[model samples]
Target: MIHQYQLNGYNIVLDVNSGSVHCVDDLAYDIIALYQTTEKQQIINKMLVKYAAVPEINKAEIIEVLDDLAGLKKTEKLFTPDIYQSKAFDFKNRSTMIKALCLHVAHTCNLNCQYCFASQGKYHGERACMSFEVGKQALDFLVANSGEMTNLEVDFFGGEPLMNWNVVKQIVGYGRKIQKEHQKNFRFTLTTNGMLIDDEVIEFANNEMHNVVLSLDGRKKVHDHFRKTFDGSGSYDLVVPKFQKFVKMRGDKNYYVRGTFTHNNTDFTNDILHMADLGFNELSMEPVVCAPDDPYALQEEDLPQLYGQYELLAQEMIKRNKSGKGFTFYHYMIDLEAGPCIYKRISGCGSGTEYLAVTPWGELYPCHQFVGDPKYSMGDVWQGVTNTELQTQFKLCNAYARADCQGCWARLYCSGGCAANAFHATGSIKGTYEYGCKLFLKRIECAIMVKVAEATLDSTATE
Candidate 1:
């Protein structure tokens, strides 16, 4: 069997190179170097019972290895310097590079969903759809900041992006134009309700954009439970069949159907199956956030059920991916943990990378979740990240800066959970992320197990 090494106390991270063990403290090299200086690799199983006891490090072993290599000192080394520089165990690159740009095409939606986070009652603010000029500026920010990346994704999002098709058309048209001019590849995705997904949107999505994130809360009854119009009527009856039509229009490969669920959902399992059967190969399910007058809250037990659903769904998608069936969720939430994490600005998700949301008024914010909110707004596009004399305010607000989160195994990968969610849950951004850091780490572990299992099954089949 191949060597699989894990450190005591820290189970999420694995030191693949030195076959050593150390905590993912700040995802830096210091801990690894410090651990190796103790020669813990020499007595791999030796338990250090006493802290005051002198270390029994073996210098002879080092001399023996050095002597063995002395005869070949003149031989050219095969390894390149770049290989050594990039040897730090990490997923892809370290800098929080922005692979996706979320453009807030519009703020107002055609429908008045009851539980809409950005709805009238929930959100005490208003801004129209981003004009073409603002969209161009957002695109310019990405183009200028995009380093060592040729493929860029532009994700159109809003209360309902389809409500403003003209802006979306102009943005995509301009993005493609600029991409060609700069010799870069530009991809597109959209997040919208199927209520407005007509022929023009379908044509643009299928032929131009990569995916469309349709907001279907679940099956009709469960969906109608929370998501409704301002008239207090369910949107399910309207969106379900249209959802099917939209799915058929673009097919599974091009479009991804996503849904939200709250405690009001009477049948969560059935809803998952409903979307799976509705030809939505890519399905994302998130629990609803409670309101002040909300009667229900998500129970902790729901997580296990969610885990089971993800496992089953991933298995089904794996089979589909192998047999060329039809659709896959693209291994949505797997392969996060199970490796040494490098400390970098960007992690698995783009918290600091190429994702920034610009509102209609040319205000620059971290993501759509912040947008016009002054509390979360990083800076204005007019001012150019200059709200403070420090580095980007978003960087100051980033999840990695908390003292409570330092030395956390999930820090490098999760980059601290969403800063806005942190603020929403607790009074401060750093405050709540501390409480939920372990869960983020746990999610990474769960993803790693799934990826490992998938890899093993594939290897077995090949053998």
Candidate 2:
């Protein structure tokens, strides 16, 4: 939250998370504690009342406390987290920005996973894999257009990206080339189904890519029920053995475990623990999307139950996180674990800001979900990343693009939830995921409560 303060002769503003401060619209020193008068308190209080329009009572308290304390004052007008967040998107110095690009390598997958979001199983019209040539071409465009990316990240996605291993290989190869040419540090990751991620792929990935997102929805029974091979045999056993083999790749650093949760895979908390028991450290989860082909589905009222499940899942993770064991979350993963979200301007989950997509034919798109939705496709592969209507919807379709998330203060925090998911599940971006959005806000509120509680304890300790 952005809060403003006046102390001594400076107007102090702080971005509470990063502790970045500004004084008189210029860079000011950050302060962790504020009760030590040190002669700067009186001037500060008066300044707050004058410049910040601090509440009279708060100003009186500040004035009373100013002469006696060094770094403490009660200025109501000071910028706090909520105040700063009110202007999050417009804040000039906010530190979140897109640091990586999730590039879809192949639109095709080897197996048809029931809970698959990309609608990969259906061989509908124009649904083909991105050829090796088009893959290289897209990378070329990305590298050429990466004007100021110092630490660029390339995230590979697919039906089962390994189906087009050549595409993955070339992107890695070209990513290296770009890293060298641009003198930047580049990182690579792949989200795969682990079917063909054999020794050869592991070696290349370990050497070249830093992380790999391997999907494991639940325990064997649950996973196999949805993810299956062409013959309808369960892919769970296949994935488990391969995952075991992959983790046994002789490296102490285990990075290839990702968990996805669908509505069918109930027991949200157990699923989290289950993944941890599987020796995986992190997981990303979303509600399962059922296309016309999905056998099971909700009757509309089931969304609240799913929302409750999400809350329970979040609470479980928080418990595990506090248990001294290593666990990671996927949606708000970086914000919770890493030092604040680096990529700014709402979590641009493929909504046109930094980098978009090029279909197998090289047509630009907002994301892979649209590989089926032709209206969102820009130009064919031969053309560049065209700023098409789909692209606009990707960013500015505020109604569908942002929707009720706009009314939310956490809107920027969660990047208005996933845009594609918004369209797919809600029927339009204007639609609201009341459950998903509220769950996120609840978690954010939890963080706030924890911070407040910590401050209270610290105060008692000092006293």
Best by TM-score: 2
Quote the lDDT for 14 in model 2. Answer: 40
What overall lDDT, based on C-alpha atoms, would model 1 receive against the true structure?
0.57
Q: Cα RMSD to native, each candidate? A: 9.0, 9.4
Model 2 lDDT per residue over 1-463, tens place: 4544432233444444343333332122222234333345555554564556535535454454443322322433232333333343333223223344556666677777766667663324444666667767666666566666677676777667787788778777876776776677777777788889788987887787777778887677777777888788888877877777676673765474665555565565566667778766656655555553465554356556655565555455544555567576665353333444533433345455455655556666665565557666665445654544544444443321454654455554565666666677678754665555655665544343233323233222112
Prediction 1 TM-score vs. true: 0.69
lDDT of 1 at 354: 49
Provide the TM-score for each candidate, comma-separated.
0.69, 0.70
Model 2: ten consecutive residues of lowest lDDT = 24-33
How displaced is residue 161 in candidate 1, in Å?
A: 0.8
After the best TM-score superposition of candidate 2, give how far the Cα of residue 67 lies from its true spot, in angstroms.
15
Once model 1 is optimally superposed onto the true structure by TM-score, how far is the C-alpha of residue 195 displaced, in angstroms? 0.6
